[model samples]
Every structure is written in C-alpha cells, then in structure tokens.
Target: MSTFKAPKGTFDLIPPYSATYLAVRDAISGPLRRSGYGYVETPGFEDVNLFARGVGESTDIVTKEMYTLTTKGGSELALRPEGTASVLRAALEASLHKQGNLPVKLWYSGSYYRYERPQKGRYRHFSQVGAEAIGAEDPALDAELIILADQAYRSLGLRNFRILLNSLGDKECRPVYREVLQGFLRGLDLDEETRRRIEINPLRVLDDKRAEVQKQLVGAPSLADHLCDACKAYHSEVRALLTAAGVAFEDDEKLVRGLDYYTRTTFEFVHDGLGSQSAVGGGGRYDGLSEMIGGPALPSVGWALGVDRTVLALEAEGIELDIPPATSVFAVPLGEEARRVLFGLVTELRKAGVATDFGYGAKSLKSHMKNAHRSGARYALVAGERDLAEGLVQLKDMETGEQEPIALDRVVEELRAKSA
Candidate 1:
C-alpha cells in the first residue's frame, strides 16, 4: 500500500464512480451554457481579505472554516471557502461589469476547501457547479437561476429534493429588522459567543442549530414579517415568475444562509435523505457584494450545487445514471502480426470517434477476451494469424455473446455504424 494518503475529509475519485461527478457537472453547466452563461475560472487561492470582506467576517465560513496561509513574503492568502467571492473578484478585475453587457452571466465548476468535522454529506474538501448572473436586479433573473437549477436537478432524476425560498429584506428594511431581532436576542439566555453574534450579525443567531439555543428562538422575530413594500414587491414577483415557470418552492422563514451578502430572493435546495446536512445547494441575490469588494455596484445572483451531496442524494434515491461503456470497442490480437494490424484498427476506430481499447503483451485469446468483458465494451474485435491471412476479423457482441466475421478494411466503418 502507498504510505501517503489524501488529507482528512478529502477523497480521490477514480474510475466508474468519477464518471458520475463529470455527468453531474455537465448536467448543471449545460443549461447555463445554453442560457448564455459563459464559463469563468479563478485561482483556487486569493487574498484572505477578499473573502473576509466579501463573504462577511462574522460568518462561520470566514471565522472558523477558512483554510488560510501566510507566504514567505508576508502575504496572507486563503483557499477559497466558496466560489461567489472569487468569481466576482475575477469579473471585477477583468472589468466585465464595465462592458456594455448589463449582466455578465457565468458558470464554474471547481473544488473548494474548508476546515470542519466532516460528516456523511459535509466534507472539508468538496466540489460545486455554480452559476452567476451579475449586474442585474430584476426578479426575473433570480427566478431564471432557480429555474435553471431546478431543471438541472430534475434532468438528473432527483425527485426528493425541495426548494426552500425566502426574501432577506433588502437594504431598505433590513436595518429595522436587525434592530428588532437584536432586542429579542439580547433578552435571551445565551453564551458569550452567541451574545457576540447578536451584536455583529443578529440574523446568524436565528440559524443556530443547538437545541438549547433553538428553544430560546421559538418566539424570535422573522425578517419576512418586516420586509418593506419595495422588498415585498420584488420578492412577490420572483415567486410569481417561479410559479408561472412550474417551479415549486416552500417559504422558509428561517433560511438565513451562512453568508451575509444575500439580500432578497434567498433560497436553498434540500434533500430529506441527506440528514442534518440537508442542503444540497443554495444562493441568493448579493446586490451589495460588488460594492463591498471595491467594484462598481453590480447586483448579482447565483447558486452552487454540491456535487458530492448530489451523488449521495442519488444513492439515497437508488437511481443509477445511464452511463455509456468506457470502451465501446476492445480489440484482442492473437499474434504479433495480428497485434500490428489490430493496433492500426484500434487507432482508426478511435480517430473515427469510437471509444476503443486494446490488449497489450503476449496473452492467450481467452485471457484477452476476459479482459474485454471486464472493460464493459459493447463490441470486441478478435484477429488471429488465420483471420489476418484472409483479411477478415471476428466481431463479437459482448452483450449477446454473438460473433461474426467482417472484412478487415471495413471494421472501423462497421463498428462506427453499429455503435452510432
């Protein structure tokens, strides 16, 4: 066994299982691509201040989970705990917001790092496929993002996941709500850490999971009750669009996501099967984020779906993706001369866009055929000295165990036809 191992809470995806990850990423990105959301990538690490300022310092992700580092040059950097901040920073640096485009639509897939006690669906290192629509404040954009995510999940046969929606009242009314919440929280029996949160970010206290703390929050104030007319109208239009689009969501009064940037139209996708870590994905409108990061006021909305959590959700539902065979056609050559001829055929087949593999070294026909079976190939090509002499090759259907001889020169064309 190798001495080295992946760090705790991290995993290496290999083989057939890894295919699911690719499928999930593609499934999510496909809709965004068709909808005009171009792909954008950013470095895995960035100035530590970027997240502290953008994701909010009081949030648990900034205070406790962030993986930080200090360089020899005395620069403090951090592996991004989330994608939105880095994505926005890249867009700002590139001046995408300055372009004529009102909303610079984008999609990205990558790994994010955080430090936490990993559990079944929660990990220290995980993957997410995210989409963002920047520089727009329209409720339609918010509805579109939620619709796109819903379509992606439905296309993947995810039936049990539900959308939790809320509007975290925009700047107009949030201050008033915060003060009211502070008053309520200040009167509670709380710990020093909880009390400190009350001052820095009272909304975060509503998200506390501790049963004892939750007991005290039974009569706490809710933001939905204090949303001003403008915020209320904006949220109502978002809900109306989603309803018209056939997307169902439940109003969740307590859904103050871990991030502090969200304002109005906040949401989460949760699967009941995922236990306490129920959220598979979530995001909201961040109208103030660009300004917070020293960029122009570019309102944005986005969501990052957890690839690992999605996989777990699929397993819980007992649904298997219809993945094609890794190798479509595998060739087994009986002799050295046959090896040269079949190797050429393998190359030709692959160049023709067929997924093909071949046997290596000296091996018995039976053994090579066995390897072909294990490869999950649809067809296996077998050519021995006698067959080569006749310029013919045996094509065996792995699924049906049926074999036939075809002209050697016509193998590639025949396989392509059959595979297609």
Candidate 2:
C-alpha cells in the first residue's frame, strides 16, 4: 500500500524554512503591534453567508475559491478564504465598535484556504499576516495602513516591491462609473463568461489578465475620470499623506483589486520578482462592508500580506534572513550517573534563560557530539563519569574546536558569562 501524502494543491512547512516564514510574519506584524493594533484571532472557518455577503457573491473568492461544508446540524460553513471579511464579522459580533475607541485596530496571522490551481507563490492552503482598522472614515487612516505595510516590507530588507494605489469611489459616484464602464465593456469581443462579468461587476473585467481580453480594453474608460468631487478629494488626501510620509506609490487608476467590498482607497504591494503572482499583498478601504454584512455603518481599511509569496520574493532577490540558532548549547552526558547530573545542570541552565538541548536516548560520545554540531549550538557541555568525579564538566566551544574544564558548581555562571 502507498503511504499517505498531503492533499493536492496543499503543502506543509517544515524545518529551517518554517523559521523564515515565522520571521516574515513577525516582520509584517511588527509595525501594527507598535501602532496600537491589538492581536485578534477568529475561527478557521466561519458562517458561509458571512463571506458570501461581505466579500460579495460576484467576486471569485466567494463564488469559486471558498472551501465550504455543511454541518450535520444543517448549517453551512466555509474555511476562511481571506482575512478582512471574517475579521470585520468578529469585530462587529463582539461589539468592538460600541467601545469608546472609534477605530478598533487589529492584527492577525494565520493560514487561509482557497481552492485555486496552486503554483509557485499561490497555494490551496497559505499563510498571511493581516491588519485591520475598523470604524474609521478618515483618509489618514487609509494612509496609515499603507505606510505601515511599507514599513514592514522595508524592515524585511525588501526593496523591489512597488505600491499601486487607486480609488474605487463609494456609493455616490461608483455607480456612475460602473454604468459607463459597463457600456464600454459590453461592446468588446469577449467570451460568454467575460460578458456575464461585465454586467455583474464591470470593474472586475478591468482586472482580467488574459492578453486577448486586455487587447480590447485599450480605450476603456478610467474610473479616475468619473470620481465625484468628494471621492476625488478623499483619494487626493490619501495620496498627499503617503507622500508626506515619504512612502512612494504609483497611481494605477485601473487597480480595482479582487475584492468587491473595497471602496474609496485601494492599494496593492507588488514585487516584480514574483512573475505572474506579483502581488505580495494588497487591501483598501471597505467603507460599506459593515453594512453589507448586516452591521452598523463602520468604515474600515486593512491589508493581508502573503507570507508564502513574501518568502518567495526574498529568494528571488537572493536575500537571506539572519535567523539565530534555536539551540545555543547542547549537553551530552556519558554513563547513567553523568546523565542524572547533567540533566540537573541542563534544567538549571534552561531556567537561567539559556537555550539548551540535551543528547537523548543514551547515544555514544561520538554520536552525541555529532548531534551537537548539527544543532548549530555555540557550545557543548560534555560530562563523563570521570569528569563528574572531579566536580567538573568539559565545556567545548563548537566554533573553535576548543575545550576546557569548568567546576560543576560554576557551570551555569561560566556558560552565561561566555555566552554574554
């Protein structure tokens, strides 16, 4: 019989590489943590209609990509395909909006599921670090989210990413642009599905990547041209704030992101290094998303950075993260008596805040030393029966191939001083 394997389109994160993924997540969430964004977590799966209504029935995420299931109790649920909608739902359910704070800033990191055809940077199961600022309508809030994301990428030493900014006018003006865009899209030589999308969400047609479809969109109307006075000023203020903060961005009038909830400010972080899956992260203001999901009119903005794609981008640029070793010291005890003594020392060292590992399974000295070397430890504490009898342990510096005898009572103090 064949051994089991991970399901198709999904992959596991293991070992040394998982460390890099963790570092990327920490880097992305660092700015949010410092800027009053509290950590928030939601269920891996949520009520199906939460997404269906919040993310919009017309978008691909809700219609094609979501992983859904029916419970034995006859309730429908879906593994969260993205972070924003679920986060908003959680915030509203808990009445975070009712609190004195107008905007409930939050940060989250976790895996999201989507039934997409997996590729290098895209996966059926993927990880993201996301931030949300709920219950605010100020343009500065929009700019703040964008600036924080920029700071995160820079903190990771990434320089090849570009920010694409756009404005999807809110209720008052977007309808006018939608009508004009629809009229233009209707006349295009497109397939049946493309035609259907034009009527449902014409802006999404602008996001279509096919060369044939793009060719006919050459003279398509620009949303920037139809922005109402209020929307134009709001978008302009967002641009000014980003510029004042020295965050560079390009105005991409056609960037209507994949989500149907976004309105007013929309921005995407794209890296040229990642080929077709260039978008490492993106988000925008979803001013009406709260109402769409049956909550109060709470304007919000947020972004989710793809951890898997960010790691890929790091490789593309040939950058390595400086991750310290997990184990700083390895303890190898020889003989049963030495094992008991050294185990006590190991516990004491660990309590002293030293990262220590031990040689388990009573391995030979040679095997234990080899394991110590593989652990990336800076020092190894090797104690045999003879050394213990002398009230001593052999301290071996893994780096310089040097060894010295230290009094057993002073082991912890000596190691701490050496490490310092």
Candidate 3:
C-alpha cells in the first residue's frame, strides 16, 4: 500500500517554520489591533455570486482560479479566493453597518483558496492577514490602511519592499478613460482573449505581465490623466497623508488592481527579492463593493498581506525571525516512582506559567536526556527514586552544562524564577 500525501499544489505548515508564520501574522496584525481595528473571522466558502459580482467577471480570479462547488441543495458556493468581498458580505449580513458605526473597521486572518498552478509564493491554499474599513469614503482612511501596512513590514525588519499607488478613477471618469484605452487596445495585434478583455475591462490589460502585451501598452493612455476633479482631490489627499506619515510610495499610472470594484485609490506592496511572485500584498478602495453584493452603498478600503509570501521575502533577505524555543524545561524521570513525582512537578511547573515538557516513554536516563536536548529546552529536570526520597531533583542547565540539586517542593518556584 502507498502512503497518503497532501494534495498536489498544496503544502502543510509544520513546526519551526509554522512558528515563523505565526510570528509574521502577529507582526502584521499588531498595528491594526492597536489602531482600533477589531478582529473578524468568516467561513472558508461563500456564495459564488458574491465573488462574481464583487471581484469582477473579467478577472482571472473569478473566471479561472476560483474553486467552486454545488451542494446537494443546489446552492453554488466557492472557496473564497480573496478576502474583501466575503468580509463585506459578512459585515452587511450581520447588520454591522446599521449599528451606528459609519465605518466598520475590521481585521481578519485566514486561509484563501485558488486553483492556480502552485509556485514558490503562489499556492493552492495560502494564508493572509487582511483589514477592511467599510462605509467611509474619506481619503485619510485610505492613507491609514496603507500606512499601517507599511508599518507592519518595517516592524518585521523588511526594507526592500516598495509601495505602488494609483487612482482608478471613480464611476464618473473611469468609463471615459476605459473607452479611450479600449480604442487603443483594439488597434493592437492581440489574441481573441486580449481583445475581449479590452471591451470588458481595459485596465486589466495594462496589468498584463506578458512581454508582448506590455510592449503594446507602452503608449496606452494613463489613468492619472483621466481622473475627475473629485477623484483627483481624493487621491491627492491620500498621497499627501502617506507622504506626511513617512510612508514612501510610487505613483504608478497603470496600477488598476485586478478587481472590478476598486475606485479612486489602489496600492500594492512589492518586494524585489522575490522573483516573479513579488507582490507580498495589495488592496484598494472598493467604494461600490457593498452595493454590488446587495448591501447599501458602504464605500470601503482594505489590504491583504500574504503570510506565505512575506515568509519567503524574509528568507530572500536572509532574515531569521527571533522565535523563542517552545519548550523551556524538559522533565526526565528515572523510574516509576520518579515518573509520578516528576510528572506532578511538570504539571505544577506548567500551571505556574512555565513551558514544560516531559520525556514520555523513555526508559533510560541517557535516552530521556537525548529527548530533552532534541526538544530545544534550556533546562532539564531529572529525578530518580533516591533523589525524590531525599526531597530533591537535579536541575541541569542545558546551555551551561551545570547541574544542581533543588528541594523537590520548591521545583515550581525555582524554575519560574529562572525562566523569568
């Protein structure tokens, strides 16, 4: 019989590395938590139409990458490929908007699924830490989200990532610019799919990474030039706020993120260290998303930072996170009576806030000590029948190779002080 394995294109997060992933998530979410953003969690799957209407019908995420299914009840659902739409749906469904809070500030962390060809940073299943501020259209809100994301990366000691900002022009002017861009794109020698995208969404063509498509896009009309007066002022305020906060960014004229709902402001964080999959995270002002998903006109701004991509970026920069050892003390019992006594002490130590682990099923002292060393514990507690009879246990400092006998009754107090 063959052994089972994780599905292709998906990988499991195990110990050591999983610890770093957790630290990265905490670092990214720390600032948001301090800034009045409350934590939220939603299901892994949502109504299929929610994404189709919110993420855009022309984008690859909806048309190609989404993992969808139909239930026995005939309801179509999809594993959420992105965070914003589902989050907005949840807030609206819960009547959070009607609770007297104009902008419902929320942060979420979870796994999102996509059926793309998995690469180093791109996976079938990926984790992200996302933030959303709904029901507000203020430029400061946009700037705040961007600044927080910047602070998060900096707190992680990441220095090479760059922020790319752009204004996608709200409902008023975007249509005019779309027509002009479509006219130009239609003239280029392109495939049928590219030509079709020109009609549905010309902005996505500008985001096309293909060398041929990019070459043709050199003379395309810039969205910056087509912004309406209102959008121009809104984008200018967001830019000024970011600059004032010392959050540097580049004004990319073609940064129409691959979402249909984004309006006025869009930004992405890219790291040069990662080869092709360089976008560690990005989001924008989806002012019409709430309405698109059957909710009221709750304008919003949000960003989702890729936990997996950020970890890869840390590795590319040769940066190792300072993660403490999981086990601070390993208990090794020499005999049956010693096991009972040591186990009791281990429980006591744990209750006193010490990270303690016991050497289970190891018979010999040498074997138990070896297991203790493998646990990455700083100290080891060894107690035998004779030692317990004398009301003492040997405390061995794993780092210094020093051992001393302590009163068995005072084991918990002694270890707590040492750990502190």
**Predicted model with the maximum lDDT:** 1
Greater-lDDT candidate between 1 and 2: 1
lDDT of each: 0.94, 0.94, 0.93
Candidate 2 structure lDDT: 0.94
All candidates' TM-scores? 0.99, 0.98, 0.98
Please give the range of 10 consecutive residues that has the lowest summed lDDT in model 1: 94-103
Give the count of colliding residue pairs in each prediction: 0, 0, 0
| Candidate 1: residue pairs that collide | none
Q: Which ranges in model 2 have alpha carbons more than 4 Å from their true place?
A: none
lDDT of 1 by residue, 1-420 (tens): 999999999999999899999999988888999999999999999999999999999999999999999999999999999999999999999988889878999999999999999888889999999999999999999999999999999999999999999999888899999999999999999999999999999999988999999999998888888999999999999999999999999998998999989999899999999889999999999999999989988989999999999999999899899988789999999999999999999999999999999999899988998999999999999999999899999999998989999998899899999989
TM-score of 3: 0.98
Which sections of candidate 3 miss by over 4 Å? none
- lDDT at 290, model 2: 93
By lDDT, the candidates rank as 1, 2, 3
Please give the distance, in angstroms, between residue 313's alpha carbon in candidate 3 and its true position after superposition: 0.2
Q: After superposition, how far is residue 86 of candidate 2 from its true place, in Å?
A: 0.9
**Candidate 2 lDDT, 246-274, residue by residue in tens:** 99999998899998899999999999999
